[model samples]
Target: MPKVIAQIYPSLGGTSEMSRHRPIGRDPYAFHTVMHGLRQIAQAMDELGYWGLSHVEHHFHSEGVEVSPDPGLWNLYLGQYTKRLRHGQFGYVLPARDPLRLAEEIAMIDHMLEGRLFVGVARGYQSRWVDVLGQRIGVRASSPGDRAGERRNKELFFEHFRIMKLAWEKDLLQYRSRHYEVPFPFESGIADWPAAGLTREFGVPGEVDDDGALRGVSVVPSPFQDPHPPLFQPFSQSRTTVAWAARNGLIPITTFAPIETAGWFAGLYRDEAARAGRDYALGQNMGLVRSFSIHRSRSAAQDAIERYEMLAWREWYGSFGHLGGFRFPGEEGQVPRPGEDVAARLQQVGLIIGGTVDDVKRQLDVQLSAVPFEYLVWHLPYAVMPLGETLDQLELFAHEVMPEFGMTPPEPPRLRVPESSRERPETRASEG
Candidate 1:
């Protein structure tokens, strides 16, 4: 049996903010707001039996975009506030970053969490970010064949990870690379310009190594998870990414592939895993995530689904620049317009289970039996849904729906990141 895991996203729209992706919840998107009543929220998940709540590391976006911005702090705060909640963050954009600093933060967090950490890696979704962060542009930007941008992102990520592993394993920091040179660069270039070598051209202050070679400073603070935290990679429409993840040992979290396509996607992972001498667990490398809402009565479920179709999906679904997921139960044109049985739509995706408790139970049993997914991340506080009502819904979920999955809602993930590495670098959004 696959152990069940659940997640909560901290962005206001994460679970608590339902529909307001239109205007900046924070004008200027700064001076963040403090979350209220975490105790109640934690108690609700714990009692109802969820596994974890994850903090996403998303980015800075223009008017028509929304993504998680400050996962570093969000992860820590939410983890500390709730017990049994496992914490997760996919992490700062891999490119345009100092890997040493990233290594330090991940290590610290894992130690603090006492082994309850799930770390994911991604090249970021934005193409322009390469130019913004002083990287070469026009790599894989035009088409799938032109995957220069993504390939570069993957290269930098793997190189940094190699160094990160070294930092975690060895106490003596000495690795020689084009990026991080050792033997103390400052010591090597004595007769001419000291350790400050050609690095100045790239804007990095050069230093000397003990071996009289021009080198740079070593990254400090290794990671805490032994052999490092579990790595999960993001899934967009990139076939290269999927193949790369399979070659390497990475768990995958995907988007864009709807539920009907889930088995098809699962087949991809399983096939890759087979070639690599590994069996892909249903929820391990492949997680099928969708939105869910459980109402107390069947009538209420019907009403909410009705309201969702007529009022919610059209206004907010494609508003934030998302192209799909607009069709709701009973809505005129959802993606899998299989038919109008709201119950079937609910059963199909396992996302909005709006029936009475027993009805919810039947729906829950069917979905779980079908997917056995590792994690279930609710979009709580869905657009137009108020926080109070969100809380009430959570309470109802705990009471009526949670038990069907057979999980103990693990402690919220731990707050282990240090003060220095608490802020994630912003990854821009997709123009599409």
Candidate 2:
């Protein structure tokens, strides 16, 4: 059986704002309440033998749906409180930030966790994040009328990722791409001109040398894991991206899509890995994230899920309604259209695994039987559920559902990179 992980999209009392129909009841310390609740959830998952916990990164949201700006920061905070549970970013939007800084941060966090960090990178989905960053980063200005902003996003994502990989594996890094010119001069002569190295030319006080350009730059403190930490791509709906991830040795993660849709994407990854002459293990790499709730009765579970759907799914489906889903029971060969009923959309998408223990167990059995997945990340601590109920739900999952699947918290992977040697260069100065 694969590991069962917990996934959280932390809320800061904003659920009420997203929908009045299922408003989050007033709490004076909603922000503090959510943080405390998350800590408890992390502690419980650690004690209850959960494989790990993963967080999502979202920003500029007034709706309070997702309050996490940097999932890595949250992962670091939770790492201190948990004993053995791994921490993951379910993901970070690659095109929106500096990948080199991200790599260094990830390496630091991985070391803090003793090499238990799992990284998931994505080309961002939200228009607000991508467009705003595109303008701020001058991508939108440079590439006018390109895929309405998607072309630059994909290009930047790949370019940044390429540099990040080099930062991890290379001793000295310099690269050139259509999008970026890394370490501009391509070589730093500090080794030869130890006294005067580009320091005077750039007007910075240092080991002075005009010959040294912005070159020989490397992400110091290389990752604790050999080569790099485990890399994952959170959204696998795109066949092109799935194939790319597989070829580049990244685990592809899928959720909210139909079972068949996820299965197809996973299949594409496997095929690509095979073509690349790499052995692909479903239990080690393939991940499926699903929203779930197990209750005393099926009707009780359904009612609770419906309330949550109003708060979350309505907005989600309304915004991303073009995806294949939205059908009545037994309805086949129907294409999804926008503005469909949220309940129908949820059902069609197989978005929730809510019901009694037996009901959820059955759903898991069916899905697992079809997809030889290795990781099952349960979306929990939903906004509609009170903190107490959410904790109970996680405990219930740990005790009842995980056992049925023969799941257990996995042992921490043995680190392959030399830890002490990497830390020795912590104070090494370099170019911007």
TM-score of 2: 0.84
Best by TM-score: 2
lDDT of 2 by residue, 79-156 (tens): 889878889988888887887898898888888888878898877767666667656675432133466566777778
Error of 1 at 26 (Å): 3.2
Cα displacement (angstroms), candidate 1, residue 301, comes to 3.1
How displaced is residue 423 in candidate 1, in Å?
A: 37
Clashing pairs in 2: 196-208, 196-209, 197-208, 197-209, 198-209
- Each candidate: RMSD: 10.6, 6.1
In angstroms, how far off is 296's CA in candidate 2? 0.9
* Alpha-carbon lDDT of model 1: 0.53
Tens-digit lDDT string for candidate 1 (1-432) = 333334333334432232344444453332243254444565455555666555455554333223356555655655666556556665456555666777777777766666566676656555444346535422222223446655665566677666665766664456666555444352353334453444344323344433434444444444555567767675433455666676677766655444445444556766777788887665456665554556656777676665533232334433533434423324355454545453344445555555677876776566556656565555453223445666777777666566555645454333346444554332222322
